[model samples]
Target: MKTSQSYTESGYTHGHSAPVLAAHATRSAATSAGYLLPELEPGMSLLDIGCGPGTVTLDLAERVRPGRVVGVDPSLEALEAARDEASRRGDRTTDFMAADVAELPFADASFDVVHAHQVLQHLQDPVGALRGMARVSASLVAVRDVEYRTMSWYPDIPGLDKWLDTYRAIARANAAEPDAGRHLKSWARAAGLEDLQVTASTWCYTDPESVHWWSGSQAARVSGQTFARQAVEIGRSRADVEEMRRAWLDWGASPDAYFAMVHTELLARVPARR
Candidate 1:
């Protein structure tokens, strides 16, 4: 609700990831599969890195009933939104804090499960963050990230390439790394994590309409958070943005349209019991 859509120095101004994740199928996967917390049982502690809007935290807390869940995020806006939702749910077991993922305040081996989704791709030092999570978790460290640099497409949609370029440019303009997804497994392994397991997942939207629509929708959502902080001169237009969005969706929904969405994650056990 900030009046100006000017791009900010932070690149990603709003906590848009939370919303996108909340609406997408990935959250459902977490809800059903426990998001790689297989060894976990009730009363175990859980930590969510970059916990936007608290949806995953609250839901996981519910899953592991009578257990405490802590959601940590760096964005005050995301924390505020999460706090409001937690209060409304009257979930006393769920709590959120404003904190950096790389420098968690919790004690060593404090949690049983430490989970992060689509987080490392935004980090400049993903290995450091994983090390932090490894230090804090007593059992497991799970990380899910998308390789943004691997995002590819076919057919020439007007403005499609520009959108990706601007998006990557804005992301790199900030202190963030835009290609974080390229080697998530390597980073997790490099973080001193052994017994590592990695999985590759893909979401193919062949609806032609919905697949492209999904892309456009994603583009619009990301650009708003990524580019809105710029001055008016550098700000993207709503109309142009909408056009790209429509094109994307139209492409997705078209008969010739095909989409391959790739995401990867790593699950590792704590190497040492401190």
Candidate 2:
């Protein structure tokens, strides 16, 4: 898919390559879903923005069965893959569409809940997108994003440190925020949302299996993803990028290795329509 000006110029730094999609497919509704809403009514309508691969969208579909659930993204490749996943899972209720968050095609107050995950960090106008989402939600709007600066790994691997530096630089070059998690609430407020609730959460990789998966996926991402190319465009050498990839692999191989990435979650209640 061609990049959209509505999104970051880097346009999904972790492109939907096989390795990246494989990692995303591992996520499920129960495992990484529904932190924004404590409970979902069966009849609640939902719209999931930037719903890559639709894993979490399907989970939300299950939670609100007999209600409409739509997952929207600008990438047709991601929407097609998500449709295939839904078909494989026998999920007929969830729908995938190509839409930009800053200008959703839906009418005002069309959904009971609107959610986006790991999406705002990649957008050049996150607050503007949030305002658009709020316009379509009748009651709730939820968002979660990572603070790349808060990411930590054990044993102080130099390569990993370099990886972080390069990734942050690339994000900045794209005019997007790399540390968006800490600013979610403020963004929501600036979007004119009130009755806000903010919380922080962490995704920790400690077990050998989890660490291996996390580190291996990141290694492939740094070496083979669009992110790698963007890093080069910003004057980082290929050899340096390879070194970061190798460091990720080495960290994955370590028995004592652990990595934790912090995310900030915000759930805002939309004001009732007059």
Error of 1 at 140 (Å): 0.7
Per-residue lDDT, model 1, residue 123, is 65
lDDT of 1 by residue, 1-274 (tens): 2221222224342335544534432354354224475666788889988777777677778767777789887777677878887888888768898878767899999998898876776666678888999999998888777666666666567666666665566555444556665587788778878898887776566664556456665655644544444322346666665665566655655566665656776788886673
For all predicted structures, in order, the TM-scores are: 0.77, 0.95
- Those runs of model 1 whose alpha carbons end farther than 4 Å from true positions after fitting are 1-26, 29-37, 87-90, 152-156, 207-216, 222-225, 228-246, 249-258
lDDT of model number 1: 0.67
Query: Where is model 2 poorest over a 10-residue stretch in terms of lDDT?
Result: 1-10
Residue-level lDDT tens digits of model 2 in 1-274: 2345475223766777778777877876655654764757899999999887888898888888898999998777778889999999999879999988878999999999999888899888888999999999999998888999999999688999999999988877777789999999889989999899888888899998999899889998888858778888889898999899999999999999989989898999999999
Off-target runs (Cα >4 Å) in candidate 2 are 1-5, 8-10
The per-residue C-alpha lDDT of model 2 at residue 234 equals 88
Clashing pairs in 2: none
